[model samples]
Target: MDLKDEFYSAVDAVHNNISFEATTANEISTFETSIRFLGGLLSAHDLSGDARLLAKARDVGDMLYKAFDTPERMPIPKWDFHAALDEGSVQGSPGQLLLAEMGSYSLDFTRLSLLTRDPKYHELAARITDLLYETQMTTKVPGLWPSHVGLTADSLDRGSDYTFGAEADSAYEYTAKMVALLGGQVGQYEEMYARSVDAAAKYLFYRPLNPGDEDILVSGTARSHAGSGAPWTETSAQHLSCFAGGMLALGGRLTGNKSHVDMGGKLARGCVWLYKGGPRGLLPEATMLVACPDAGDCAWERDIGVWHDALRRKYGTSKPVEDVIADNRLPQGWVNIYGGCYILRPEAIESVFVLYRVTGDRKLMDEAWEMWAAIDKATRTAMANSAVEDVNPPGGKRLRMSDSMESFWLSETLKYFYLLYSEPELMSLDEWVFNTEAHPLRRMLS
Candidate 1:
């Protein structure tokens, strides 16, 4: 059958047979359900103007809303949907919750409210954002909340580790995007985003000690050090953290901050640099880099011996520096490959797509094309694309493939690649705001 026939058939199958209750898993992820399924249905409705999709989306929304029925009305990271529905039993929120899990529901929930004209959905989601804003400044680091936090009002400052990665990445991301999605009516999101970005620039972003001394920044973790009396930066980078580039660019344009847009460009280029310098022109899941003393004014280390010495010290290796260097065969600026696998992640391309839309720079498009080519070459299999077992393979040999494929390969990664080259006016940035999963929700603003 043709593509349009296949699309209609798939939608009909979902509308006729899909049921949230059919799953046998005891628990469900609030974040995953919201983005992958609810957001998908809503965006599909937005695109196809299908009332059936909206009905399906509303059913999922109602089921997910039960997750926020805790004592403090904070969402449980892992929700027991069966208990909530079958036994009328709901558990209290956990002592510590991931910021992303609690904070990432705004876009989907808010859009659900607007579409269904049900304020309850939006109200439940707004309460979470309200608590986040109230606690944003009072955290261990002012203006940015920690990766983990307590749900109760009394225990808001329960965790200290902070980063724009993993558990905390999308919280900051949603803040900026929410501003656009809500048409800037909510000033709190804009303020929260600006403060968090400012703090991140000062503490969480660092320049890598590369040969070119390129003016690019990568997001990293920070912790309060007792001896230094300040937060110390960890120069480890994650592919997941690459979304910060797009988040920064979108926020800058919405808030009219030129510097943020410029910084976004540099950060996007930094991810491209990682892809180009890797063993097979693909970024690993995680890597460590030698950090420059200053992010704004960085100079490359002149002594190659010093670079090797630093790596040895960082890894606490007893072997000779030369031997240490020979074992890893790391690229310049990279000290260690904490996670060498490539799991078909989409964050780098997500940033590239956003920056191209924001800047209209054709160079970003070229960079994106190179990234697509590398990924297609390295991951393609007979059945489908697989994850790379090692992005930094030894001996410059062929990359080893793992027999795994994540849903994001189709949901977010391929979507970004397609949108990168598609006409800009199709799902235009001004018209739609994407959730953390890259599902495009129609913007309410004119």
Candidate 2:
């Protein structure tokens, strides 16, 4: 496995051929480019101490720097690289700006600044974080920003829907990670993370009414009420939100909050339960669950009449409650499968790896092994593993295969799986902190 020749050959190819000067795509995602390419190159250079990798990373970093040329200096989520190069200026979009896209750039740019001994990169990234922190309390829901905001007119309070899901997940994640990456010297990162996570736990975290009455928590969405009432919680869960467990656990360890660590374990276990609950032993991309009134104290509703009544309230007389139940054919607590496909996402395992590191829990590793076995058996293809169309198919039928494999399948999913079994000393959390894409950037202080 120590194929040095192959590694150098691949590096040489990238160094020689890869260029951001002429991208074929009309537009590129700043978040995706920063995390996948810039973060990857920086981590690779840190591991190999190779000048070429740093050079290539610098090239990518320069291209990404063009994204912050807006009038307000806030980065445009999507950058037209060629157009910007030609015009020597960039314009911010008038549409809604995603929270994750705008907020997830601090780590990569700050790392680049440290390595290159340039303050400009860190300064540019810090401006965005400053804006986010300033606007955090002004949103409809204090301490939590919506999924999107208006950046062109400098309005950060544009959207109302809130969730720690796809569009908004990594914003909170970076807040905690930035605390580690900068050696917690900033203080504001920790404050921002603490406030946001506290709000999330109060409004978004809930216990599912599973038949086993498992003591675990799942993050859900919340809608701010029109008046001064509490935000209404939605019981739907997303596979992407699985990262909250690791985020919370890491933040707790960094900030000396034992409660966050305990809650994190509960959240991590919920995903493990979902993996084991599915027919394929893999979690669906998204699912709806019946929530207990109090997440802190929950007991399973044993009466089938309650489930029937809940289904009736959800579906009405449009369809028989029995048919609705049979159509989903899910476990007792799961009301329906919003997204049935398993697209080889890494969020669940990412949390498992992190929790194991934070708690030294061997049981988490065993659970991870079971998940890997199930996923391999169901998704293995001749060339490589493919995604399955249905993770909870009825009647034990075969899972339909899809010809899609995302980059994170390797960068994050398998990396976390491998690290779970590796020695604890290898990439220990004390010495390294992972970005959203699971790239392990070396911590400045251990």
TM-score, predicted candidate 1 vs. hidden true structure: 0.95
By summed lDDT, the worst window of 10 consecutive residues in model 1 runs over: 224-233
Q: Per-model C-alpha lDDT, please?
A: 0.85, 0.85
Q: Which tens-of-lDDT digit does each residue in 411-445 have in candidate 1?
A: 89999999989899977999998888888888887
TM-scores of the models, in the order given: 0.95, 0.95
User: Could you give me the TM-score of model 2 versus the true structure?
Assistant: 0.95
Q: What is the lDDT, from 0 to 100, of the residue 146 in candidate 2?
A: 86
The worst-scoring run of ten residues by lDDT in candidate 2 lies at 87-96
Q: List the residue pairs that clash in candidate 1.
A: none
lDDT of residue 94 for candidate 2:
30
lDDT of 2 at 414: 96
